[model samples]
Target: MITIILICIGVLFNIFGCVGLIRLPDVYNRLQAATKCVTLGCCSILLGVVFHYGLSDAGFKALFAIPILFFSATVAAHALIRGAYHFGTKLGEKSVKDDYKEVVK
Candidate 1:
């Protein structure tokens, strides 16, 4: 019941992430959106797994993975974007600002 609901919500988030990845204008925006949404989605699914399986091995693994996924996804996204910026990737035409433009150099 609750597990199913959580799983469904997670699935929706994952779908939204995929959509964002496809529709966003630039690499940075797309990666940020996909990372954030997918991280939350995967964490939610892992939580549902914990609820469904309790303290079993699989549940424990899923529980452990939640934090790893959350941190890694965000950190990886930041690193990738920073690297892209440093490598001279241009911002999208519609981007209103570049917070890193002055600070990064």
Candidate 2:
């Protein structure tokens, strides 16, 4: 029951992330949406797996993967966004703030 709920929530989050990717105006915004939402969604699904399998091997794997996915996804997104910015990718028109603009040379 709980597992199903968690999985359903995770699936919804994943769907939101996909939608964000399609609808966002620029690469930076799209990447932010994809990274945060999808990472959280996957982590939730993995938590569901842990609840379902308890102390089994599959559950342990899922447990370990949660942190790896979270950290790796965030780090990778930051790196990609930084690279894109350095390569001269511009932000969306509606974007109001750019902390990086002042910091990065």
**Which candidate achieves the best TM-score against the true structure?**
2
> How would you encode candidate 2's per-residue C-alpha lDDT over 62-105 as one tens digit per residue?
99998899789989998999899999998989989888888778
TM-score quality measure for candidate 2: 0.92
Q: Model 1: per-residue lDDT, tens digit, 85-105? A: 899999999999877788877
For candidate 2, which ten residues in a row score worst on lDDT?
A: 96-105
Clashes of each: 0, 0
Error of 2 at 105 (Å): 4.4
Please give the lDDT score at residue 102 for candidate 2.
Answer: 89
Question: Cα deviation in Å at residue 13, candidate 2?
Answer: 0.1
Candidate 1 lDDT score at position 13: 98
Q: Model 2: residues >4 Å from true position, as ranges?
A: 102-105
How does residue 96 of candidate 1 score in lDDT? 90
Error of 2 at 2 (Å): 0.8
